[model samples]
Target: METKNNKVFLETIHRKLGFCSTTYVDPVGLSGGLALWWKIEVDIDIETSSKNIVHTIISDKSNSSVWAASFIYGSPNREGRDQVWDDLMGIGRTEILPWLCIGNFNEILSSEDKMGGNNPNPARFTSFHGMLSVCGLFDLGFKGPKFTWRNNRRDGDLIMERIDMAFANAKWRELHNQAMVFVDAAIGSDHNPLILNTSFPMQKVGKPFRFESFWTTKESCKSIIEEAWAVEYEGTKMVKVCKKLRGCKEKLKKKLELGFNPDYLVTEKIIKGKLEDLWQKDAMFWHQRSRIKWLQMGDKNSRFFHLSTIQRRQRNQIVKLKDDSDLWKTEANDIAVVYFVGNLVTWRTLAIIGIIPCMVQVVGVFFIPELVKIGKEKDLEATLQRLRGKDADVSQEAAEIRDYFEIVQQLPKARFLDMFQRKYAHSLTVALMVKSSFYKFVTFEVPKTLSFLNCHEHNLNQNKDLTAILVFSGIQLYVATAVGCRVRVTDSHANTLLPLDIKGSAGSLITFCNWASAWVVSYGYIFILDWNPAGTFFILAGICASTVVFVAKLVPETKGRTLEEIQASLTLFT
Candidate 1:
């Protein structure tokens, strides 16, 4: 209200808020002032003005409905309030239309409105109450903060008051019966901004379901989940999974609703312990001083006077955010209690950061060699039992793990040098499969598969869909041909050149390399294909070289030889 009527400031405001027609009361000696602005869409005329008033006549241009709105700023001091009350009485006499009296009255009607202050004077409260009664103005109900004006203090001596309020006469109330005054989130201001909304009754949104970690400690949690999952549902496996999850969600929500209470966060229990510690320290200090105890300015329990001091300092300052949720949520009072409880026991945090890793992960790493060696028919069950917690039943599981581990111990452990042996060509094929799988998934398949699935799911088909389909079919045919050739490699020659396992492994190796080549050709030139033309020749040359080498070296002329003779001939080269 004390803002200077500067040219730059006015122009900036106009640029921001647009060129709305406005009338304002300027402050006297930088003390106090007011401004009323409206769009051309709504007709507003200044009816009158005074030191603390911006009375206006507002009309709906479409409906031609009119109302008298009195924007009041009650005198800051109690002495001048009497004159403001008198002015309000005079204004009431002139009110011919439905009237709305809004803004800060700098007064409250009850002791409940003030916090951390001495009981308000009964006479002052009565005077304000009486004025509202005579003026036919009743307080319009509000949502959000019960207290609007905070004293800008977060320390123990912080004060809050509900002095600012909206009051409408009976005719005005009937005109917009659902009208509400919401105390919007405060911006660390002494007073919260008030919003008069007549559109609809604001709803206090219920909080969504949140699974708390503490629920697992309750015995009922297991029973609730089991019961919910036991309910039958008809669907595919995915649909059943979703339905069961929804059932569990509802059950957990119901259980929490019945058990949860806000009182658990009270500071009384912990603050009392803090006071006890403080008492011990204070007694020690006084005893050691040995004299002048009475001369001390403070009492024995001075530090413990108000547990309210435990709350966070300056933590109440919250700024407005674009999201609507922030508009109704004010800073909570229990923030300090949470901090006090957290700092009171720092070991919980330390245990999570330090000791937890050793118990679960670090110990497992140390035992890995022994774990791998202990493979048996039942050893997998033993590992699972260890994971489930010591209290779980594990006698049967232990036996299962032991049997499973023993069975696993009988299997061959393939080694690197084994792959080089002619009898174990399968290992080399396995290596190629692993190498190509990575490249194919990352480069060739992922982007195309994702684009295809997305297009179908979202009905996002473009004209290029047929090209994508043709490319898919071509890839399938190429893969089939490569696979069939691997099957016929043994048939092409009368030689038992490789064991069946080795032959299959070689085939897998060939198929993997084929995909790997496609991945490189598809993705490698994608970037340079835009800038240079030679990438095409480089790819074509690679294909030609691969075909020539295959025909010239890998293909053998073993047309009519017996299996044993062909094997002997290939063996000579080996």
Candidate 2:
């Protein structure tokens, strides 16, 4: 029915039922921009039943708000659908106690719900099921209304589908004795309106209880009077009273726990068990199907089998990882898997280039000095002839040889050898040292013969005890240590003193370098110089120059001290 103003219609419903009213508009587009919709929502508190509050909404094409209210645009393919549902459920769970979720979902629950025989996408159906489970919603049984919508085409083919549905939450299920759906007669429209009847009795105003004068005193309390009354009865009355009190206490405790410990109490075990049971049931069905040829012919039942199989596998995985003993272990395993895959990809890329430079660099760094010394003494056949031809400028030749030796010394032997080995021996050694020192700082160990002072301190803190030593031994720590060693080496080469005196900040710097390398590795080609030999030499020279500067300026001095003491002594040197 049309009213003078659209607001008046909601007001009239509120006056008839005596309940609070509110309206919600769903935004247009998946990204959540405001849009026009024709939707009206009404909440009625019927004096008939404490829990029987009617929430109804009606909308049409004139107001696009109805479409938004029903989350028409919030499809799986569209963005922010999950967030919208989460927010909607949060509000519905809090404000509405006994919820009756009825609207045009704009999506079908299953292929059976649609008129056409066209196959439905499994992924979309899975997403719909997930939404239903997340909200803890169940379909209210409707026998009369088979279809709510029909095809608008002029063709002889008449296709009808049930796009509209009614869902109820746990609260509604508790108070509702019975529910049934009635399909109203269609009046030229392509859709049918559904009428729901719930069996709930009307409630009357309750009278306030009056207390006697003696009840005001603390000693003459309600519990004492109830106990006296129970004592007057037989053994059955005492047992019933005790049972009633116990039930009330248990219920109160549960209510308090639900309010205060919601996060910890929301266990998914029941859901997981249900999923597992589905798998076992399906397995039995498959065995039965294998034995009977008629069952094999009817393959439609296999749909449930497939769905349950997938859900069972997923739930099993979640349960395994969520177990108390397996949480951190599973996380560590996942981290290791990622690390292994990344390392494999990196090594594969290097192998494709067929460059043996790392190997050559390793041989040169470790064995070149010995080889050069031996070659000088054993291969001296051309020395006399070269001396005769050039008047034997001994001093100049010696100077040139000395310069070559110095350049060789600055070739970053340990760093180059590590790259060649691909085992990161030197980096791993430093990391172990750092980890050991960190452990020592955090752990308290008693010596075989404790001093008097140590014994006193131990006695003072007797109540508290420490267990489960923190060990950062994994890919995360390994990567951090490698980056730290590289940064230290780079600084040493450039002769620059890094700001290592700041406590705990060195780790932060190393972490930044590790993160930065991920982005830098992608743009390696941008830093490539000319391919000519002279250009290569120039690039090498530049590296040497930078190394010298870093060594002089940034590298911190760590000649004869442990890592733990290094931070404390940093300021003394500077």
**Which candidate wins on TM-score?**
1
How high is the lDDT of residue 315 in model 2? Answer: 25
lDDT of 2 by residue, 1-574 (tens): 1111344445555454333443323223322221112223422222111111123333333323221112232332434445545554554554444555665454577788876645667665565567667666667656455787787765556677776667666555444534445555566766676665554222223533332232222232444445544433335867867876655445444444455333422552346655554454455555343343444433546443443333233222311122211122224455465456555665335433333433433333334333343555222323422534665554554444445545555554333223323233233223223322221111211110122223333433321222111111222333454444455553231112222221112223333333333333323311332133234334433533444464345344565655545444334222
Full-model lDDT, candidate 2: 0.41
TM-score on alpha carbons, each prediction: 0.42, 0.25
What would you estimate as the lDDT of candidate 1? 0.57
Model 2 residue 203 CA deviation (Å) reads: 23
Clashes of each: 14, 28
lDDT of each: 0.57, 0.41
User: In candidate 2, what residue range of length 10 has the lowest lDDT sum?
Assistant: 440-449
Cα misplacement distance, residue 306 of candidate 1 (Å): 44
